[model samples]
Target chain A: MAVLFGGVACLALAGGVGVIASRRPVHSVLALLLVLGSLAVDYLLLDAQFIAVLQLIIYAGAIVVLFVFVIMLLHARSGEVARVPAVLPPAAAIPVCAVFGLMLLVVLTGAAIAPAAVGPAFGTVQEVGRALFSRFLLPFEAASIVLLIGMIGAVVLGKRLPPSPPDAGRPAEGPGEGRSKRRVELR
Target chain B: MSTADLVLVGPELVLTIAAVVVLLQDAWATGGVLEPQTPRPAAVWGSLAAVGLALVWDVGGRRWGPAFGGMYVRDQFTMIADLAALAAAGLGILLSSAYLPRVRLPAGEYHALLLLATVGAMVMAASGSLITLFLGLEILSFSLYVLAAIARRSRRSLEAGLKYLLLGAFATAFFAYGIALIFGATGSIDLREIGAARPSRLLGAGIALLTVGLAFEGALVPFHAWAPDVYEGAPLPVTAFMSVVAKVGAFAGLLRVFPLALAHLAGVWGPMLAAIAVVTMILGNLAALFQTNLKRLLAYSGIAHAGYLMIGVAAGGPAGTWSVLFYLLVYVAMNLGAFGVLLLLARQGMEADRVEDLAGLSGRAPWAAAALVLFLVSLAGLPLTAGFIAKLYLFRAALGAHQPVPALVGVLTSVVSVYYYLRVASAALSGGAPQAVAVLRNRLVGAALVLATAGVLWLGLFPAGFTAAVQQAARQAAAAVR
Candidate 1:
């Protein structure tokens, strides 16, 4: 058990560092996928099987796909100037180190004195399902509402207009009115 | 969820279904491979019916207690807050009924988004858990984002939408991080459990961040960079809806969580919030004093009002919470009417957003001019109006809670706000060209304006009965909090 924990923890740490150390955006994103994938494995180790599955499908699958697509859409290229910095400047590191130090202090002081061992049912699918269906139902439904609103918002905001007979709209153009007319970028 | 639990969230469920129906029906009717028809009468009526039903269910005499394992609850506080939110939506719909076409926006999507936003606000108001509160806030914020940008050809509207979305998300991050900290400290997501938590760095940090998030929504100053621009840019009805409903939703959650869950830690936090209230009131009023744009002025005023409401929270007791409720209700009527009157200017192909546009409104549209003055007076907290009563109660509550400095700040800021409120009134009533922009005549808008005015005057003239109802609800709020 100790060996397994040490190996996975080291792998996750390496992946986190690699995510920032990589010169290429693509490499950075790939390293992020690694971190997420290993994080899912950690959830699995902790017996949060449902969350582990969600992590795999949602974060590793959907979110990373979105990231890759965005990179592709932006036509990302790895060149000397285009490359992301592998390390932060001293100025940036000050705040970053400060935050890290604070978190360490908090974790040290507020650490759980003892964590009670729970049955295997604690994070199992059936147990989670029971709790969600009964006690957590309102929030469950609220989450769905949030998702539905997200879907509607995305479609409404993303819809494009056909800028036909553009001359006819000329008379209505006031100061800064050029933006009111929609222009498709990719097309 | 059991049927019994379902009963508690009945209004939210009805609104959810109604919103979806409105969205689908509007899309089917208006957006297809054919020439579009005006969004059907049935769609708007259906949505209105849903809102009415929600209002009824909210204020209805049903047993109130925790539901969904205490994550969501129906209580007097939630009910009163929901009632105010629903009233704002109702007025918003009425205003949109007339204003949307003039602005060249679709009604179907607008009304649907508005209903969905109301549902979000209601959820936020009623949530017993932080997770629920966060979800509700997201729901509200997203719908408003879409609603703000619905003016497809309006750059200002789109800008407003983008600004609101970016700033709102930032605030949400603060809120989520705070919730995580609180959960880490207390090992629970429930606000009631959070109230019982021992003081610690984790809890203090959590409460501070949580206050930041709520302050953003409430438009308390220093966190209020988004309000002026967003208010200036969005469609007037959307502005009115956002101004009132967002505050009510956020304040309801603040009232619930702070006065209960974090009441234990108020010794450290209360003074901090009171200072915020002082700054918010002073800065908000001072900003409003110079604003020429009517909507922007109202936005600053909205921030100032947030200061008053935070006084209720800082006051940290039953009196404070109930005063917040009373203030929110009064705020809805006056603020909604003020924005609704601005919709009258849309008939001229001009957004009546400017103080200059309101000049000579008295001669041009007597009733609108009168209504605007009434709302402004109420907003200024003048005697014999709802605003005065609301402020009086709020200050009394503030002193009762031993937050004397904030109470004093509240009184002084009311005096400062009077100048700007009267400025708007004078701009409207004073001399200029009497050439009237033909006002759009919609039965619903006219009806809503009348209702707002009646609510304002009735509550002012006859405070006895309303005060009694507020007292009853305050008792319930106390019981639920305890």
Candidate 2:
């Protein structure tokens, strides 16, 4: 059991690193899928069957497919230059990251984790549903609004503008500008 | 949930429903296509009516207690915050009505997002549990992010949106991690439960991280790098609305977490917040002095005002709570009114945002120039305006809580702030040849200006009635934790 856990965890870690380190957008999505799949396996190993299935179905299957769709839709080139400027230089970022990691290490090492006993229904779909509908109802309902706002924002920001009039002078710089440029490059 | 639960969140429901209706109405009216130049009055009036109705629910409903398994609360604190947020939303829409069509922004989306953002602030103010608070904060931040970038035609607006989103996401991560740590330490995410649990180093670190997140939202110093740029780059009405709404939401969360929930640990966080307050005031004011852009200047002034409000938060008592509430109400008026005057100067596809834009304003538009003077003076905390009374209450609260140093710094900073605030005022009152900045003659903006001006004067001159009411409410709120 311990070896199985260790192997899956290592796979997940490697997949996470690949997601960030990959040069190609398609490769990054594939790496993300690996991470999600490994996480699901780890959940299954822990006897969280329902959660493991949900993880595979929602994140690995649906969400990753969506990422691929977006990447394809944008025609993201493999060698596209990073347009957004880096906030911190690597010289500064390295030490900051090292310090943060050290702090996390210290905090985690010092803290004691005492796992609480759970009921027989723990990790069951029914139990999770009950909690969602009862004690956590407010946040659950509020999350819908969050999702709704996300949809609205995606439409408002991502929608292509109608063809500009000849006399419109300079065209308005919408989010679609970069996408159209990329499409032209592809063609 | 029960009918009572729904009633408790009546204002939020009204606004949410209104947002959906406005969005649908927009889709129906525009047929999902950008059209000829007429501005949709329906969106503006619908949003105004929604805000007005929400205000009625907030005041008239008056069902004060916890709901949603103690996740949400409707009390005097929430009421005061709702009033401030609703006021900002109403005035923000009024200010945006004329500018929308001129810029060809979809009025429906703008008004819907604005209404939703207002609901987010109201939720944050009414949150009883940490989960509710975080959710409310996300809702508020998300809507504002979109609204900030709604003017996609402008590269500056898009840049502002991206910057705001990245920094804001970082802040939210800090906040969420802090909540996790607090829950781990106390084994509960409820504010009252956390208060009852004994404090530990974990809890302390969590609280500090939580303060960082709230301070970022409030635009307090050190966490305020994005405020000036975002304020300058976002559309004028967005800047105006967000300036007040963000502060209202942040300060409300601060009041809940520090004073009401964690009052017993005041010794731990009080001095920490006081130090932040002092620096925020000094840095915010000093920074404002160098800014030539009116939007950026107001942004810095906002940071300084956050410091003043923090003094009240650090005080941690009934006096502190009510003073913060009163100051927020006054801030909505003064800040929005100042932005409203600037909104009038917005012409076809460009905002008259520079300090020079207000030059010769007295010659061109006397009422606007005069109104700008009133708002700036109020912001400078001069007597006969609500800003003075607000500062007075905050300083007294600090002194009453035995924090004389912050009070002294507050006074000194207000003096320095006057220099900058009056510079803008004087430019409008008496400057060289007035630039041909076309001031949009819209009655909606004029009515908003009148309403905000009345609120400022009423709160300043005859503050007795509101003061008494807030004091009573503050006492009740403070008693709830005990």
Pick the lDDT winner. 2
- Cα lDDT tens digits, model 2, A1-187, are 9999999999999998788777777887899999999999988876778889999999998999999988876765643533333245798689658845764765676667566566777667998899899989989988888888999998888887665522367332222221122312110
The lDDT for every candidate, in the order shown, is 0.81, 0.87
List residue ranges in candidate 2 displaced over 4 A: A1-47, A72-106, A109-113, A165-187, B347-349, B432-435
Candidate 1 structure quality by residue, lDDT tens digits, B1-482: 57887788989888889988887887777762111224357666888899999888878746688888889878877888888989998888887776665444666667788998999889988888998898888888889888877665567777888999999997899889899888877788898877776777777667777887888988997799999888877877888899999998889888878875666666787888889899999999999998877888999999999999989888877788788888898999999999888877742344757777788888877998899999999999999999999999989988887889998888888998999899889988997843544555678888889999998998778877767776677678667656
Q: What is each candidate's DockQ, to 2 decimals?
A: 0.32, 0.29
Q: Compute the DockQ of candidate 1.
A: 0.32
Docking class of 2: acceptable
- C-alpha DockQ for predicted model 2: 0.29
Candidate 2 Cα deviation (angstroms), residue A45? 5.8
Query: Which ranges in model 1 have alpha carbons more than 4 Å from their true place?
Result: A1-28, A76-117, A164-187, B32-39, B434-438
